[model samples]
Target: MWTASAVLPGAGPADWRELRRDGEAAEFHAATEMLELHGAETEAYLHGLTAEIPSLYVIMRETAGECPLEIVQITASPYEAQDYTDSGEEIVEKVPMPHGLVAWVRDFVEEFHQDEIFVKRKRDKKRIDIVEDGVGDPRIDKAADIYASPSLKRRRLQ
Candidate 1:
């Protein structure tokens, strides 16, 4: 998967913004250093990170505020991941970010939102219907179909 990773330096927000928007590719270490010069908050966030998860990627857009940038993280896990592992990243409407970070990201810049990459979910248009070989009772009935229910019965009223 193609990704963009650019660090914002304290020297120039314009350059960082340009790189973020137009650059084909950028490295993290170089970017991290540039951002550190601008804000302690961003520096601290980077310092806290030990390693990057290979499955996820993020594009941090420079905000108008003093902070480094507003970043939106999303998974790049391959389609085949579902075939191998039963447990996979859930289909999420948005990335899960800490409350404090979310607040910070929004505050750092005005109208901060996720920078999305075009990744479409492809599924074969095949209908999955009820198919069975051996069965105890035919479920299709006329009046009512018996579903598993509570055994307790109501008492008769006087």
Candidate 2:
């Protein structure tokens, strides 16, 4: 079965702990707050945490076959689990995030995360012209010239 856990940083080993699934939601209680997450929202919350916090991570575990358990680290964008998997065997289960953790992640993301805007570069209109003009071979140049000349338009006679 797929299970989710919270890895809290501290001096003690108990800092890393498993979250309990209650009904449709997973819950985690800290000294200050309680986190609960449900359904697909859990995954998004964990992903946000992994992206915003350096020490926080979402782990996908597979408990079968020779490996028994294989752990994969979830990242924000560039290092997604799908990018590393070469075959179906490498696929693992996704776990949900706890409720309190979601709130923490939301706060972290709000404060630290900056969305990157992608700007599409305009294609050069003269690129083909440059390639045709730069060709040194006489045969290729002749063909290009023939293909490009507007006066060579084919006319149909009835």
Candidate 3:
């Protein structure tokens, strides 16, 4: 999987530039691709930003066209990035998050993030431990050893 060396911001449409080629190895620079942030995914964005080394995920897909690879997605949310990794058909790379992009994400998170409150569930007072009503087959009428197998019960009767 190829990693993005850098991100170049642009005001116009997206385009690519050939960097260099060494026979079989070649590099291209893709520009003007925008990374969008959603309010609903603020939690995922927060998890990514708080990591030890915050990063941007680049997902590339292999194509049969003239271009060998195509950029599928560029994501700031690690959770979203993880989804692409599971497919095994796409290439996922971790690129160090740019300072400006990090700040932008932080601003978006600050505006949309909401803390969820935890609620503990209370157990009902039903006394289920006192009885073993369904432990044995209903066909057997014995009360003392309900756990005994049907064969054992038949043997005891004989």
Candidate 4:
């Protein structure tokens, strides 16, 4: 990968203390050295490149309480988690497994729905008192012209 001609090139043998090489090889070595210098950045970039596709990872994080939870990582997953009890918040249970994950989630959701308290939506109960008057006459009084405005009479263009 690294070449000696790159390290020492056509510059000259004048400076014996320091080695001089071809500028092209030096440039190549410099590029490699620059890449190596940002090892962490390069690794992160490569990781991001590989992470273009959606993946599921169970991330365990310490929460307010003393228990660790499985935080699901997904770009997009149709699974929804719901928790309502002495425990605090809902947890993500959706993760790519061999199988039966959907059934487990469905059972969990069913149990949760059975035990969870759902407050009934309060109806507005608004009173709409529509008073009807005597509306017998369907005939309309109109001007000689149909397009005449109430404020300004229709202008006649000759």
Candidate 5:
């Protein structure tokens, strides 16, 4: 289990730092990741930040190259994380957000988040009961009774 212990503020250049090693299990820390916020994604970020735990989602992807696993993304938006999880190869983990980062995200959301107004679309009240031309029951020929099937039409003709 790869757990994010902490995010160093303004740390220069991030790389995997080995934390501890057990018999077979080992822990590596990837630091100095910058979480970018978008104006369009503020709604998603707000939804995630308001959660009881207010956690960040870490997305790890399997690489075909020399590195077996790679840190693809770290997102505050659960929606973004969910998108990555749709691909079975990616591993998504929810890590608890730092208090300072939570506050920072709150400020960003407050500044960018705008309430979208809901407008109910008015449906057309036009009568659809009247059958249009060439839209009647196709089983009956135009020369036969509208209610009659092809068999009935043949019998009537006979």
Candidate 6:
């Protein structure tokens, strides 16, 4: 089983302390403690966490109005903090995965991920006669002109 949590920067220590003091505050707040996942559900959630789009925009309702900001996503099973920004900003803070978690992820990837084999398409053998005898060659003159009929006009009028 894996767990996920969303930590917003705007919700500072003071807000967290208040949330701790009043358990009911958690219901109203965007910050969730931990959400458990299982089986294929875990894999699906993990895929979302590992997606290329790192940061997600979330609407925060304040007394004045609603504000939106990009927030980092964190996962527990594989234990990764994906801090991605759309503005091409470099992420300074690093969240290292534990050795056990790394091994587990590796095993999961090995079991599920399969590399697609590249098979080069075989080229059709060139007809030596076609290359040797040009289009207007006398040898191919006996061949029927399929495009000779006016009824077979290729153009279409809109």
Best-fitting candidate, scored by lDDT: 3
Model 4: per-residue lDDT, tens digit, 1-158? 22212221223333223334575433222111110112223322233223433222222233455323322222112221122212544333323432243343334434433333689999787766866454333342363433443454469899
Candidate 2 TM-score, C-alpha based: 0.39
lDDT by residue for model 6 over 43-147, one digit each (tens)?
A: 443554475533222222223234222223334333222323233442323234344544555456556655558899997897766563323434333346433
Ranking by lDDT: 3, 5, 2, 6, 1, 4
Highest TM-score scorer = 5
| Global CA lDDT computed for model 2 | 0.44
**Best-first order by TM-score:** 5, 3, 2, 6, 1, 4
The lowest-lDDT stretch of 10 consecutive residues in candidate 3 is 149-158
- The models' CA-based lDDT, in order, is 0.35, 0.44, 0.80, 0.31, 0.78, 0.37
Q: List, residue by residue over 1-158, the lDDT tens digit for candidate 5.
A: 54554555565775676667888887766645668888999999889987998988888876677555687777899999999989888888888888888999999999989999999999899989987664557776674466555554444554
- Listed in order, each prediction's TM-score against the native is 0.20, 0.39, 0.71, 0.17, 0.73, 0.28
List model 1 lDDT by residue over 1-158, tens digit each.
22243222233323233333346554333133221112323322332222242222233444567544544333222222233234333222222334444344435433332344789999988877767544333443422434433244569999
Kindly indicate the candidate among 2 and 4 with the higher TM-score. 2
Expressed as tens digits, the lDDT of each residue in 97-123 for candidate 3 is 888888999999999999889899999
Report each candidate's C-alpha RMSD, comma-separated, in the order given.
17.6, 13.4, 6.5, 23.1, 6.6, 12.0
lDDT score for candidate 1 against the true structure: 0.35
**Model 4, position 23: C-alpha lDDT score:** 55
